[model samples]
Target: MKIILSTLNAKYVHHALALRYLSKSVPDARVMAFTINHTVESVCAELYKKITTDTLLGFSVYIWNVEMTLRVLARLKKVAPQLKILLGGPEVSYDPFETLTANTFVDYVIYGEGENTFKALCNANDCVSLHSIEGLAFRQDGQVIVNPPRPLIQDLDTIPSPYTSAELAAFEGKMLYYETSRGCPFTCSYCLSSTTHGVRFFSLDRVLADLRAMLDHRVGQVKFVDRTFNCSNVRTKAIVTFLIQNAAQTNFHFEIAAHLMDDALLALLKSAPTGLFQLEIGVQSTHAKTIQAIHRQTDFEKIATHVKALRQADNMHLHLDVIAGLPYEDYEAFQKTFNDVYALKPHALQLGFLKLLKGAAIRDFEGYTYCDCAPYEVLATPWLTHAQLLALKRMEDMVE
Candidate 1:
């Protein structure tokens, strides 16, 4: 029962689209994806030369590779003590029994949205079919058993396309993650998509036949992982007027909500073409009490009048973001939220620093202080200090 699927990616052109939707519902699962620049003894000596002891292996954890995927599954279960770990996204899907009681060599996790609980746990074989697999979380006699969560998959075109044609030749120069949508009309309390609630969609003829099969494999970039991708202005002008009428050189990143732009989607993204669209937005703090203490529903003057009308229509690629230590932001109110997002002249600005993740809603807010592990960042807050978050990390290293 091999079933492998993995993830570590923080670079090398990033690709694990949820291990290609859990390898299209476990069709003899085997994915592998690695990146946090490898080491953990070279990814457990290449997964101990392709696993055994009845394999299982799954991973896909987050918060930038959950502490190197728990030190590469605690050194691959101390060199394969009958191999069979497992864990799933959103950093162990919000505490699956405190992630199997502090990772006892994680024998299972598969919380929310893991393609029908990892294809009913690779077609379960015993323990009374793992107690009827519903977003499982394992261990028994020594108790852990999390079950009962697997709901959110309302026919997202019955989850399939991980772009076949042998996965678009393993997506040549990487960057090709696409998703027509999935929950986030706005809950924004330092997002984990605000502990999931609404939005779903996948049919606009299954998103223009999955962007006409990644613009007929011209795939240089696609990146829509939809946290908001314009939260539906008729599917953002029919997917940006079908990627400006069938994207020629691909290029298409998203993450939008710039006060929900319009004026006919900024005149169809000011008639695209110059580096065909990029966007990104997230102005995390212009400090109206740190955007009402992070329930962030922005309007920063209509995001500075639609990022100064898409930077004077210099043809797309905006990128703005902010975040430095929230809840009434300090250090002189984050320098006026970084000079009001650096006077919106963004072609890219970022400067982020607040992380407090693991089931976010601002980690139940109250005088912050973080880094208890895997990117729980903040480190000082009764109105910011830790030497002003190390002088906002040396002003984010001189604004990169």
Candidate 2:
């Protein structure tokens, strides 16, 4: 069996890791993974030229984007009808019903965590009892069936490293990406990370081992995909200290909760090697009402102080984010947020429009208006009109 797992771009490194873990559980399954640059059409054309029709037996294709999945499925059906297409990740998982029912191209949709479900599907000869499979959705007997959710993977150390030493070598002296944990502790309405109510950490020993492996591969830089790297101060300190001790080899980056930082963590980060660490802090908005509405409660003063401290250290590269189209934030309010976050002088200021993803609290609110397009992103809320959304989008482009 041959399985191909892919990302829309190089940025979605975590998806590759998850698929790699799934690939390990299936014996004799040759996995071919690639990062598609732009459109699905381009990707399929390239695949058609590379892979011949005779080679598509017991093959599985997994993709992140709906359009990409559909395009690949259409081509595969015409050329190799036996190939199975499995859809997962945030883009497809957001609205599996519409994606499954509307598009006949997708054979199965893996909801929530995909590692176990993917492994099961790969190893099974017949998928009739798909309902018995946890964390999966598929069409059975002309009806769409959704299985019960699976428990989160508690033992992160049990999973093998996604990249082999040789595979990691491809990224040597280039961009490196890895994840230290699975879920997020915060409940920010606009984020998919909030779907998981709490945090889960990988084994400290396993993490250190992965770091050592990356170092051996001569990986120049590593980015941690954890939503909030500092949710556990003890774990955060341990990882930071380990990196600092081995600063000559690995330079790690993290996305953190700025307001959650205390004096102890700051002291450690302050002394860490310069150019060895980076932090991305999500300051979604500065307005109190907007913060409350979005269910993100943080002390702005504390965040400001902590950011200032990190910036003063001249060691950590800082990045801040703000969203323009929140429930209660008006244009003026958004301006204030931009100015306040920009004042921190972050290396990059990411201004994003609100996206009402599936299973998010904001999606339940009937007060918001949405765009009807391929992406199906949110347009505006009752608090902000459609025109304001256009303005914000333009502003974001200009600022970014």
Candidate 3:
């Protein structure tokens, strides 16, 4: 059987770690990655024509690529109806039955962390065998069958890096993704991280070795996919100290909570070699009501102080983020949020609009309306009018 793993990334420079993990789990299968913005049509055409009837194509779905992937799946089915299609990731995991029944082209969906489930699925003999695989959702005799959820991988280290020589060769001048840990400790309402229960760490030894390997290969950049890198101070310091001690040429980036930074953490980061570390901190909003509404915690004063302190080092590149169209954050309020984040003189200011993702708390809450698209971005809220939201979007574009 020819099993092919595919995904549509947000950009050409971005690489999806989920695809890599699934590929690593099934070493024999080939991986085909594509970007969402440009060449999507051409890519769909190419895959539809090149794939044979015997091929089994699996797509990694995301809020950004759900529509594009569906389009591709539809076209591919018309060309090769015998081809089997599989879907996975957080987007499909929430409503697998509806997705499977609504789209006949999708043969199956392996929800959640798919490394183990996907491995079992690829080895299945027939449709009957597919029923035995745990954590799967499929259609059997015109009825959708949703199997029990798969347990999270207790030992994250068991899943090896997807960085085979052939895989690494494909990302030559592109970005690389590394996960030092899984799950986030915080329960931010708008984030999917809340669904995850506990934090699990990869062995520090394994992480150091992986870091060394990436440094040896000298990839463009390695971005840690961990939701919150500094959630655990011990692990954070260990990893940071290793990077500082190793002192390689490759750049490492992480998304961390700025308010969580203590003097010790700041001291550790302040001494890093210039260009070795880049940090992205999500300061979603400055308004207290919005922050509380979204269940997001931030010590603005502490964050400002820590951020400014790190900037003096001239080594750390801090990227501060602000979200527009959030609860109780009107245009004027978002303007204040933007101005507040801007005052920090961050290397980059990421102005993001609120996306009411599936399973996020905002979806269950009231007072918001959003587009019914893949990235269900907020169209308007009681606090922020549609015109105000559009104005903020324009300002964000200009700021970027």
| Structural similarity to truth (TM-score) of each candidate | 0.36, 0.90, 0.96
- Residue pairs clashing in model 1 are 370-379
For residues 1-400, what per-residue lDDT tens digits would candidate 3 score against the true structure? 8888899888877877888888888887787888887565787776776588588899999998898889888988887889989999888888788889889888899887899999998888888887888899987777889888889999988998768666665655567998988898888888998888889999999888887777667677889989999988778998899889988667889999988877888999999999999999999888999888888777898889988998899797889898887888887888898899899999999989889888888887788899987689999898888898888878888879
lDDT of 2 by residue, 73-159 (tens): 677667656556677777767667776898775677777777777777766666665667888887777777777887888887776
Candidate structures ordered by lDDT, highest first:
3, 1, 2
**Over 4 Å off, model 2:** 10-15, 31-42, 45-64, 128-131
Task: Point to the candidate with the largest TM-score.
Answer: 3
lDDT, each prediction:
0.84, 0.74, 0.86
Model 1 residue 333 distance off true place after TM-score fit, in angstroms:
4.1
C-alpha lDDT (0 to 100) for residue 249 of candidate 3:
69
Index of the highest-lDDT prediction: 3
Two-way lDDT contest, 2 vs 3, winner: 3
Clash totals in order = 1, 0, 0
Runs off by more than 4 Å, candidate 3: 37-41, 169-173
Candidate closer to the true structure by lDDT (higher is better), 1 or 2: 1
Q: Mind giving the per-residue lDDT tens digits that candidate 1 earns over 348-388?
A: 79798888888888889887889898788988988887997
**Model 1, runs deviating above 4 Å:** 1-20, 27-88, 91-94, 99-108, 111-120, 128-136, 139-142, 145-212, 216-222, 225-251, 254-275, 281-313, 324-333, 346-355, 359-380, 384-400
The stretch of ten residues in a row with the least summed lDDT in candidate 1 is 165-174
Number of colliding residue pairs in model 1: 1
Tell me the lDDT of model 3 at 171. Answer: 55
